[model samples]
Target: MSIAVQDLEAQVLGLPPEDRARLLERLIASFEPRSKAQEAWMQLALRRQEDVRSGKAAMVPGR
Candidate 1:
């Protein structure tokens, strides 16, 4: 189920202090992009592209 931002904020505000902190942390973590695997793959792809552009690497033709 989707929640409105205002509603989520209100609910979080009503939580006990420690609970609120934990909830906020979880929410922030959930919204963050770029998991470890994705970051690694992105780095690898960028390096490959650079290598190809600089003539340091070449693509093999597919059969």
Candidate 2:
């Protein structure tokens, strides 16, 4: 990786857990959608993520 990217990575890695998670969400949002269908799926997944994070949903273990 280039020096600038390396430096940025180091800085991001140094962030606290909550700050890193916030940055991660922003990074994921910055990606261009591949298609409308895929974008809709991603939006659903993000909502589910929020539900779990907010204690409105629970994850089930696979059998």
Among all candidates shown, the one with the greatest TM-score: 2
Q: Distance (Å) between predicted and true CA of 25, model 2?
A: 13
> Could you give candidate 2's per-residue lDDT for residues 1-63 as a string of tens digits?
457988999999999999999999888977954789988998999999999999999999999
In candidate 1, residue 56 scores what lDDT?
100
Report the Cα lDDT for residue 54, model 2.
Answer: 98
**Stretches of model 1 off by over 4 angstroms after superposition:** 1-32
The C-alpha stretches of model 2 lying farther than 4 A from their native spots are 1-33
Q: Where does candidate 1 have its weakest 10-residue lDDT segment?
A: 25-34
Model 2 lowest lDDT segment of ten = 25-34
